[model samples]
Target: MNSSASSVVDPAAPPRSNPIRIGVSACLLGREVRWDGGHKRDRFVTDGLGRFVEFVPLCPEVESGLSIPRPTLRLAGEIDDPRLVFGDSGADYTEVMRSFARARLHTLADLDLCGFILKSDSPSCGLERVRVYGKGGMALRKGRGLFAAELAARFPLLPLEEEGRLNDAKLRETFVERVFAYRRWLDFVAAGVSLARMVDFHRIHKYLLLAHSPEHYAACGRLVARGKALSRAELREQYGELFMRGMARAATRGRHTNVLQHMAGYFKKQLDAASKDELHRTLDDYSDGLVPLIVPITLIRHHVRVFGLAYLEEQVYLAPHPKELMLRNQV
Candidate 1:
């Protein structure tokens, strides 16, 4: 938002040679691996986001040597450490599933996944609110699937969501943004992290981070300022943690309005009075929830291009994910 000459303008990085990779529950991709030999294919997962990302599908039950049309599974016992068991007969398969998860996670570690989409309410792949059974067969929606839990532990910073949750526009936008951001972070690390690289990364992501958390934006700035004092490993770890956590925070309408206002400041000297009023009204409409975020973003992006605001053009906040996704249109 700061249009100061000192503001870093990162050159546009070359497009990635490899497609972004996303891990997904096999059933969500229309794989007939459910216990009943059916698939829970989500059109958005396969038809929408799938166009941009290469999916690495995994069906825990099938991959764990379970047969199709097998007995349905459920989580039972303590909420903290539930057991995967047959829904009808209560045959425990906890060890089998966990052993498979541990080994499979090691394999997934090498895949450089940007995000994961899990089947909602699945016994082995649900991201959250999966039913856990207790004594007397009482059930509570307090469990996470075994494989999902393992994946979360292995990659704490990776973006993850349930297919059901993705139906919500705001959640979907946030998830996709994080996935792309994570991919960029991966590329940054792959290219070799340095103090200078960290500064550039922080610079390009400035407005995006500010939209989510001004506090975190300032905290990250402080960390980058002291980057020379810390070891590369420490700086990378601390900065990466802060950046991802800030991204995970919900970008409320108020926060988004604040960011929009800050970005609008750059066009003050360049725009005519009528154009300024139009932009102001657009921002106000967005703030009032009368329109989606895409409206103001589109106008701001147009001004950036026409005026040749290279610094703003480089900001990831303008286009975090592919436009084809239309994530910001609804949110």
Candidate 2:
């Protein structure tokens, strides 16, 4: 995954401060734990994204005492009541897997994981469109893997994705953004969340939320403003849920362009005629699909430094994850 030369750090960019903890399917990290003792190592995940976060690699089958090169397993019966069983022998291991998932997730709950990336199309790890087979040997692609289903049900708000889907630029950006935001929320709580702190949190993430869903931004603001009536626990729980949910929506190019325009306005007083024109042109190029998102974002960041715009400099929307990952360059 470490394909390129070392990345040159951006001076205006924030220091690599936050360390997001994420769970990855063990095989994706190049562990030979698959059914045939082969691994689906994802270089982008291990080399690119791995630079920013600490990965907790997990293998449900191996951890559940299943031997490598074991008989292939599949989900059988109705979609709602599918059993994890050997495909050829019809040997049921539903309880074995479910029991392992339950105990394993209980341990993970305390790890404060921000997200998980599972192996795609795996009998025990896939998330979307997994095949479910019936007694008549008919198959439907509507099933979720046993371990992945448990993880989703337990931590409904945690960002989760398949290694295969991360190939898509939009989904990759959305997941990485959510992971950082989720960690920020966790850090807020760890610092002893207070009314004033929550307000500051909402303020910093305001534009970021607007890029995802303006309605959610307004709803979150209302939640914070009406915090006087709710208990501290209630405020913490409700606001956390809304904040994460808001960030979960994929930000569209139109929405991003609007946010860029809004952000550019902050430099109106400081930028000279030439500088303003250059910034506007860069943004237009990005909006017109002629340039990557990093172009406009870099310009805005430079202005933020030159103009001493402390507020915008501190805003997480500008640099959601590590620039070393070069995530924005792709999106």
Q: Among these predicted structures, which one has the highest TM-score?
A: 1
The residue-level lDDT of candidate 2 at 95 comes to 95
Regions of candidate 1 where Cα sits further than 4 Å from its true position: 1-14
Cα lDDT tens digits for candidate 1, 212-279: 88898999999999999999999889988999889988778899999888888987678999999999
Q: Rate the local accuracy (lDDT) of all candidates.
A: 0.88, 0.86
Write the residue-wise lDDT of candidate 2 on 212-281 in tens digits: 9888899889989998888889999998888888899999888999999998888766778998889878
Compared with the true structure, model 2 gives a TM-score of 0.92
lDDT of model 1, residue 127:
85
TM-score of each: 0.95, 0.92
User: Clashing residue pairs in candidate 2, if any?
Assistant: none
